[model samples]
Target: MGRLPEAPLLLLVVTVSFLTGPDVHAGKILVFPVDGSHWVNMNLLIQNLHAKGHEVTVVRTATSWYVKEHAPHYRSITVTLPQAIVIEEEEFFVNFLMKMLEIKKEGVSPIGFMKFYWEMLNALSNIHQQASRLGVEILENRTLLQSIRDSRFDVVLLDPGLPVGVLVAHELKLPTVFNVRWITSGEGHFVVAPSPTSYVPTSGFAATDKMCFSERVKNMLFYFLNTCIDKLVVCPHYDRLVDKYFGPDVKFYHLLQGADIWLMRVDFVFEFPRPTMPNVAYIGGFQCKPSIPLSPELEEFVQSSGDHGFILMSLGTLVKGLPTEITSEIAAAFAQLPQKVIWRHTGERPGNLGNNTLLVKWMPQNDLLGHPKVKAFVAHGGTNGVYESIYHGVPVIGIPLLFDQFENVLRLEARGAARAVDATALTRQNFLEAVQDVLHNPSYRSNMRRLSALHRDQPLRPLDTAVYWIEFVMRHKGAAHLRTESYKMPWYSYYSVDVCCFLLAVLLILKAAVVGSVWFVCFRLCRRRKPKQE
Candidate 1:
């Protein structure tokens, strides 16, 4: 063959290098992930990271319901516990959901609200007490501890909701990255940023950013409740462990806030505009992608509905099914609709289930949402599902369960992209009205499409953005420059209470000196007045 020209020769070399060359970089990552729906998104990141030449190893509990023992994308290390956290049991969560639904039946009054949070406190306390044991178990195991130390893992990625990962990462002396939305304290921002309760509504408050005075009061009360949960229900579990291994001087929330990068699972598009930190990177909808072709059978089912499009419904990963009564009401409501329904549910079949509805133990929720024929989404307002609904421009009829789900749907409702139905007050009639309104409503779809456009009009894909930050931490060893030392400050210091007090004292002294000078000058100038009075 003739020798190529210089330009062509260079191009050929570049092409060859691109085709059969070494990866741009390969880094070792250690992950301590929360299971269930959280793991679903985490697994997506792991797959993408693996594709980009990173090696991932996950630390999971032996009793994990979703984090598999074997997977191609990552290796797993299972920690044995005396008992799987009581809250991890399927039965416990189902029963908890059922009871919460019952409590909510009285509606949004103070008595009903108190009953809900009281039950939440009980479950939240138990989950944290059990979850905090994972770090201790790892530390107690000499072999595991030594092995982890020897691995020289580049970074630790975790969900701070459970927060055991933060403790373990701190002990390992590795840079930490949080795949965060909720922290044990509440919303991740409350732990890591300057959140003003004046406008930034606390999770589950279901209030929007623009609030009246009374709404702000409720927001503060909700915030105070979250802080109490942290101090009373969540912190004590991790505090002793911090004292034992890390030292008493180390604050637990400080460890959480100190993560090198916070890959927040929400964007301003979905979340109300709030204060954020340099270390926090919003990567909402990172798990979303363009839909792929549906299976033949599924496609036929989807196409069966004529001009009236279908609605996809799912309660999320942990909720396999609702109580029979709720399901029956929902099913009856669906039966009244003209649109066909695909519900991802498993359990006793609803007696009133309509011919127009299809129930499955599982469904491709994301792909189905992206389908052109999907008219609306009936969901429990999970973060993942909500984001997918936005990404695909599908309006939502939200059935919020607990823990930020309410807030998620409330945001969509605020945007005119969704509607929320109180599960406690759920009835066939009410549910049917909400669904029909969403279906017929042109505003909902247009609003969601606009959100989808805004969400998509970014310089970088959210997933790639997340991967870049994760790799950014790995390359630098730590992102200390981006992290805030504010987490280490006392509350008074953090809020500048001391500075305010000092300034106030100086102002008072200046005023007092001026008053004294004026009095003295007046006495000197008007001395004859005092003599005349005598």
Candidate 2:
């Protein structure tokens, strides 16, 4: 009577075990995100990790608005970077506009373009030096370093755009995962998968994956030039700084190669076919969210436009604000459209703004794109913005500014999902016409919708896939086995060029020996015949 039945006892044991299963293991993650849009993009992943109960500590140049708002949730270490090094948006925009104006006025010439290119490279070098200085400051802080060591983070996440992040990971003796917010570039060729210049378009260039003979030549030349600049100007400064901070034996390139995974913010649907290593994961649209409800005011404005629909305009965070002249031209173009306009502006209100236009400091871009009344996006063609537009199935009039924007827009145009107009060449009439074409034409919307469907049809959400891979690396203590053997080989050896050269040398030696033997045998036979004749 006192003993329980065997089946009942087994059931009780199983129930108790189910109720008290092992707790989800939380990992300590350290993230190094540089200032600007990269940090903004990184916040999506960081927030997700925090939600999953991971302890995350981010080292940033300055606390972003998001971090400031959510400061209590995670630890943020802010490094005070010099104002001179921190590129002021106003000054940068003024200089960029002046250069564009000069180029347009003087007309495009090979010499003029080369001069501008070098000037751009110099500017980039200055930024790289600033990043190095930031790294030095962090390394010099003994208290911070000691705290990091004590924390014993499972993995260090880095933005490889800033080489100092790689140095920090090296100093911590931790496995690294690079968070690249765009397609693979030549700068990280030594670390990530090999993106050959033959088909893989370089980051900033305006060539598609399929290029003509002349375009391929130009692409190769640009790739070569960028590599030279990185090695001669960029890497040396970073290498020296890393050597000074971390031991002399710690090379920046070696630390770069130590990365276990590359989380690239690109998708195959939008990108061309290319080889990717197992360690590289495509996490495009991780930041993209399902359309949330638009604010009442925004909804009212868009709905009031009726059948004509509306256009959404934004240049993203990097450009902070826009010039008055460009804004005025944009306003003028909007005035002509039957459709209403919603412009996200950080600058003063344009005097020529149409009665139908709504201007605000910030707008819910993805939501606006999802709205049925919205028709076409006039954007700066940033990769994030492009992905969002594609996600919502909206056509685009891309006003490419800098960096990968040009190439992103070029791909969109090739896919028939968008049209690109150089900012320098954007007139009120052309801008209006482009907007009208995208709206009136049916192909743009169709192509975008098709691509949007493809993008959304993934087996798992992009963010989940990303998180799984990240934790997978942590579980393995670094997925070193997943890294391609080519990552460890020199460039020449990776392509078998060295092996080819050795084979060629051996063939040449064998050919020379064979010829010598034939000549000697012929001479001996001739001499013997001559003696017999005598």
Q: Could you say which candidate leads in lDDT?
A: 1
Error of 2 at 28 (Å): 0.9
Q: State each model's C-alpha RMSD to the native.
A: 3.0, 4.0
- The deviation in Å at residue 315 for candidate 2 is 1.0
- Itemize residue pairs with steric clashes in candidate 2: none
Instruction: Report the lDDT of model 1 for residue 384.
Output: 94
lDDT of each: 0.89, 0.79
> Residue 231's C-alpha lDDT in candidate 2?
85
User: Candidate 2 residues 1-534, lDDT tens each?
Assistant: 799999999999988977885334689898877556777778888888888788989876652333442464578777776644544234575577567656764577898898887887787778778878777878888997888899889998877776577777777778888788531224344346667778887655788789888888888888877777778877876788776877776667767766899888888888887877878888888888888888898898898899999999998877755567767888999998889999988877887888999888888888998888888999988888999998999989998776778788988999999988767777799888888899999999999999999999999888887887778777778988987655456769878999999999999999999999999999999999998999
Pick by TM-score: which candidate is best?
1
Q: Taking the tens digit of each residue's C-alpha lDDT, what string does model 1 give over 1-534?
A: 987799989998989988994335699999988877888889999999999989899998989988899999899889998768764577776877877777656457787788777877887787888898898899889999999989889999998878898888988899999998888877888888888989899866989999999999999998888788789888998988999987868888778778899999998899889888899999999999999999998899989998888999999978768888889999999998888999998889987999999998889988999999999999999999999999999999999996779889999999999999988788999999998898888999999999999999999999999999998888888899998798787889988999999999999999999999999999897996888889
| Cα RMSD for predicted model 2 | 4.0
